[model samples]
Target: MPEVLIEAVQPGSPDTGAVAHYGDPVREQRTLEGAAGLVDRSHRGIIAIPGEDRLSWLHSLTTQHLTDLRPGEGSELLVLSPHGHVEHHAVLTDDGTTTWLDTEPGTAPALLDFLNRMRFLMRVEPADVTADWALLSLVGPEARIPGIELDPPKVAPVPGAKFASADVAPRPTTVYSTAPLPGGGWARRMAYGYDLLVPRSRVAAVADELAVPWAGIWAFEALRVAARRPRYRLETDHRTIPAEVGWTADAVHLDKGCYRGQETIARVHNLGRPPRRLVLLHLDGVSTDELPAPGTAVSTADGRDVGFVGTAVRHHELGMIALAIVKRNVGDDEQLRVGVSAAAIDIP
Candidate 1:
C-alpha cells in the first residue's frame, strides 16, 4: 500500500504525506477507545514464509517458540544481534503451511535478505509480500470489526495457502490474526488491538467495509505511549537488549533453545538487572504544552543526562506523557527533566 493509496482512503486533512487524522485527532482517539475506529497500518511490512519446515526453521532462528505453534496462533518474536541487541521485531501467525510475519516499515527488505541467506538448503523459503499484502487494525475494548471473525484456536493448520508457492503467488483470501497487544500501566489505558493481514489490492475496500471512523498514526502513537507498548525503532538503540524495555514479557521465551543472542539474555537475566529500564514520564503540562521529542535528553533535576525519550505524546485523557529509558537506579520519587518541563515517573 502506497502513501497515495492511504491518502485516498483517509477522510480528513493530511498531517504529512499521509493523513494523520480525520479533522480532529482527539475525536479519533475517542472513537478508537470505543472500539469503533479503523486504523490504517498498511505502511507496515509483511513477509510470507512457506514450506514444510517453516515452523521448526523459524523456531531455531527467532526468540519465540514456534516449534509447537498451533495454526492461527499468533506470537511476537525478536531477532537479536550476536551481542544480544534487538535487530528485528515481528508478530507472526502460522497457518500450518505458511507463517505470516508482520514487521515495522522498511524492515522487510533487510529481513528478507537475512532469511534468504540463512536458508542453507532448508525446505523453507521466505519472500517480501508487503506490496501484495497490507495490514489494518481495529483497536480498543473488545476490538471487533463487523465483517471479520477472528477465532485462532478453531482453525486447523492446512497446506492450501493462497500464497504458499513463491513463484506463483496469489492474493490470500484468509485474513491472519495476531494476539491482542498487552495493555496497562497508565490511567485511561485502553485495551490494545489485533492486526489483520489483508490483500493490498482490496485494502481500501476492506477498510471501507468496517463502517467506523478512521484514525491516523498520531492517535495510535498516543495510545501506544499510554499503554506502555515499546516500538522497536523508537524504544531501542544499537545497544538495546530486550530486557531493557520489559520486552521479555511478550517477545522472549527465556527457556527456549539457543539462538544468536541467547548468551547475553541469559547473562542479563541471571545477573538480575539490565543497565537501563523503561519508564513512563508524565511531563508537567503546566510548564509547557509541548512534549519532549524522540531522542530528546532526559536528565536528573541536577542536569546529569540519564537517558533519551523514546516516544512522547499528549493522550486524549492522560494529558502529556512519554516513555523513556533511564538508569535503573533512578528512584521512584526522583524528579526528572525533559527539555524545560519537570517530569514524574509513572511506574511500569
Candidate 2:
C-alpha cells in the first residue's frame, strides 16, 4: 500500500494515509472527473449476513425497504439508535445466499455486536468479513468494467454535484454485480462509482492492473466532500440524526414499516425540523494557506460560535469547500466564519 500511495510520494504534496493522490492531486481529480480512475477502498468494512430470514430480519432492524430486496439490488440502510440518532449506515448488496453490508472502516465491530444482540429468536447470522474480503472502486465517466456486469439498479444518484450537473439521470456510474470468480464476489453501483468486493488475496493483483489513475484517501475525501456525503464519525455522532445530515431522503423510507427509531423519524419529518441541517460551505478565497480541518470551530459575524466544520477539502473544481452540520435556524444565505478567519464562507 505504501509503495503505491506513499513511498512514491510527490514532492511538495502531503502524502499520508494511503494519501489523496499517487502523485498529482489535481490530475488525479481531473481524470476521475473527466475520464476514469481506480481507487483502493479496502479500508471500508464488509459484513456478511447469512440466514434463512436474512433480508426480513435485517429489514425490520434498520431504515430502508429491504424485506423485498432482490438478489442483485442495492440500497443504503441506516442503523439508528432507539432515540433516532444514526448509529450506523451499511451500503447493501445481496447475493441470494447472503447480504453484503459495506460499513465504515472502524464501525464493523459495534454494528456486528448490535446485530447479534438483536438476534434473539431470529435465524440471522452476521459476520465481520472485512479481513477476508477486499474492496475496490472505479469511478469517473466509464461504466461496466470488464469481467463484471450487472444491470444498474435504479438506486440513488450521486446527489448531483453542487457546482455541476442539474439532472440526476443515468447514475454516476454503471453497476457491475456479476463476476466470474471461483472464490465468489460482490459488486454494486455505489459511492461515486462501482465497488467490487473480492477475495483479499486478489486485491493487489486487480489494483496493480487497473488502467487508470490512482486516488488515495485525500483525493477521495475531496470528491466525497464535493458530493456532500457524510460518514458516521465525521459528520455524525451519538446525537446525530439522519435528517440532520440529509440521510433521511437517501437512506430512510417514509412509507416503510416500523423499525427501531421510526417514531422519532416520523415525529421529526412530519412535525418538526432536524435540530441541525447539512450545508456546503464554499470558503472565501483560493488561499489554501490556512485550510480548515475537521472539528475546526465555526462561528457567525464578529465571533459568535455557530457550528464546526465536519469535512473540508481542496476540491478539484470548488477549491476549498466544507460540509457542515449547523443549527436548523442557520439561514442558507447566512454569512459565517471558519475559526477566526476574517473571510466569510458561503453556503453554496
Candidate 3:
C-alpha cells in the first residue's frame, strides 16, 4: 500500500487522510463546491516515455487512440491485462519529447517494468517523474485560472506559455513542467512559468491569490458522488471492468488496433454484457448526519443480494445519494434495503 499523508489547512478543521504525499484535506473539502482549491497529488505515479517511438509504443499497449495525441491534447485511458482485467486507469499526455502517465500511487513502478520488458527493439525509454514534479488539482467553478481555458476534458495552454494541458481522469486535466522555477521550485517549472502549486507551508497564500477557498476530501467525495464518478478503492478493483463502470465510453477506443486485452474487450462489447450496471441510489429519510459506509450491500425485500454501494455522500442539496453496481435486472424504481445495518434506499 502507498503511504498516506494528511495535512490540516484551516485553523479549525479536522485532520483528514490522503494517499498522496501532500495536501490539506480541510481546505480541499471546503473549496469543492464554490471556489477553486488545490490538492497536492505529488504521490501519484508519473512515468515519462521519451523517444520518437513513444506514441507508437504506448498505442500498441493500452486502450484509447493515442497515436494522434497532439502535444497539448489529452485523454483518459486504461491499461488492461491480456485477460481484460484492468491493470490501471490513467491520464496520459506528451510534452513533445516525453509522454507522461499519471495514475494512482504505487502503480508507476509496475507499469514502467512492464513497458521495459516489452520493448523488444523500440527506441522508447520510460522513466519515473513523480519526484521531479508536483501535482496540484483545482476544483470548483471559480477555480478556473486566467491563463487556462476550460475545454471539458482538455485544458488549453495560454499562448506563449510553456504549460501544457494536464489531462486527469476522463475529464480535463493539465500538467506543467516544473524544472525551471527561479528557486528551483516545482511550480516554476510549469510550461507557463506560473506558480500553480504552492509549498505546503504557503498553501494559504496561494489560495488567497487565486481567490479560492481550501477544500477537503469529504467535499471532494461528495462532488464525486454527485457526478457518479468511481474511485479506485471505493468503487473498483481487479474484478471491475470498463463496461461495468461506464468508463468504456471514454477510456477505450473500440476501433483502435489490437492491444493486450482487445480480444476480451471486443468479445464483451459484442457478445457479452456486464453482469452488473452502475446506478445512482437515493436514500429515503437519510441525512448528512448518518453517513453509510461504501460497499454496503443492497438487497431485495426478501434479502436477495442485488448490488453493493460503490460511493456514498451527504450532499447539501440532494441529501443522501450513492453510486452502486447492481444487477442489470434491477429496476430503477425498485426499493432495496441497504445491508443489514443501514436503512432502505431507492434507485434514482
Candidate 4:
C-alpha cells in the first residue's frame, strides 16, 4: 500500500531531517520486523570513490581493513580524530570499478573534504553522489523485493565479539545487509534489513512499486534503539570513541596497520576500558507524548549526572525505551532517571 502524505516532524535529533512518520509508526515498525517495509532514505548521503588505489588508500585511513574487501561485500568503518573520537561512520561496498559510501545526511561534505585533502598522490577520486543517487531501505525478516535477485551471503559468526561483519549480495542496485546485533547470531526481534541504492529519480517509483508497507524515520529509530544500534550523530559527541558503543567488532580491525586513531584505540582496548558504555534505558512511565528527547540528562537516583539520552521512543511492544551512553562504572542494577521519570538500564 502507498503511504498517505503526512506532515513531517523532527525525528528527535537535529542532524536527522524532518519526517517523523508516514501515517503510522507502530504498525510500520511491525511490518519492518515481519515481512518487510520500505523506508525512504533519500536524505542519506552517498559518496563514490573510483580508482585502482581506492581500497588500499581507504584501508590506510579508516578503522576497517579494506585491502582484501571483495566486490559487493558490505562492511562498516569509522574515521576518528587523532584522539580516537568518532568523526565519521560509513557503510560501504565496493564494485569492481568504484567504491560506494553510504553516510548520514550532512556528513558528505566533511568526509569528502577529508578524503580530498588526503589524496596526495593516490589514483582515487572521491565525489559526493547524493544528487545522482538515493537510498531506499527494505527492512524486515528477509530482504525481499520484487524483480531483484538478492542472495545475502552466509555470514560466519565471530565468537564472543561485540559486533558482526556485515554481509551482502552483488546486484546493480547494490544491496547490503545490516549485521545482526550482539555480534554472532540472529533473532527475529532484531530488525535485520537491507539498504538499496537507486537513482535519485527512481526512489519514489521504486518505493511505490514495493508491495510492502512504508515506514518512516520514527519507526526506524524505535527499532534501532531497541536493538541498541548506535547511530553516528545521535549516539556520538566530541569525545565519543568506538569502544564506548561496541562499534569495534563491526567497524574496527585490531590487526590492521596504523591509522590516524589507531594509537588511541589500541591503548584503550589493550590497557583500559572506555570511560563510558552504551546502555538501553527502559523509561518506566514514558508515553508517546512524554518521550524523553535526545540529549536529556540521565542521572543516578540520587541526582548525579552520568550520561545523556541518545534516542527514545514509545515502542509498540516494549512500551517506552531509549539508548544512552553512561559512565562505565554505573552499575547494571542501579536505578536511573531521565528528567523526572525513572529508568532502568540494560547494558547492551
Which candidate number has the best lDDT?
A: 4
lDDT of 3 by residue, 1-348 (tens): 133344433222122334322244443444566665555455567777889998877878888767777665556678888888778787665656777777766778888888899899999989887666555556666555544443444333212212122322322223333222222222322221123332445544545555654444456666677777765545675677777887676577665668988887777776557777787777764333454566778888878888888776666667677888788888776768675334444434
For residue 321, give model 2's deviation from the true position in Å: 0.9
Which 10-residue span in candidate 1 carries the lowest summed lDDT? 181-190
lDDT of each: 0.72, 0.72, 0.61, 0.75
Per-residue lDDT of 293 in model 4 = 74
- Please give, for residues 14-80, the per-residue lDDT of candidate 4 as tens digits: 5355356767788888888776887777788899999999999998999887787766566778999
What TM-score does candidate 1 reach? 0.82
Report the C-alpha displacement of residue 84, candidate 1, in angstroms.
1.0
Q: Which order, best to worst by lDDT? A: 4, 1, 2, 3
| Candidate 4 clashes between residue pairs 3 or more apart in a chain or in different chains | none
Taking all chains together, the TM-score of candidate 4 against the true structure is 0.85
TM-scores of the candidates in the order shown: 0.82, 0.85, 0.73, 0.85
Q: After TM-score superposition, what is the CA distance of residue 250 in candidate 1 from its true location, in Å? A: 0.7
lDDT of 4 at 342: 90
Clash pairs of candidate 2?
20-218, 20-219
Model 4 ranges off by over 4 Å: 1-8, 15-18, 147-191, 286-289
Ranking by TM-score: 4, 2, 1, 3
> Tens-digit lDDT track for model 2 on 1-348?
233553344333322334556667777777777778777777788899999899889878988867767677667889988899888988877788888888887788999999999898888889999898877777876734666665654544423212133333222122224333445576677546778788989876666655666666667677888888887777876789888887865687655668989889878876556788777888865444467767777787767777778877778788778887788887776778886453444544
- The candidate scoring highest on TM-score is 4
User: Alpha carbon lDDT of residue 120, candidate 2?
Assistant: 87
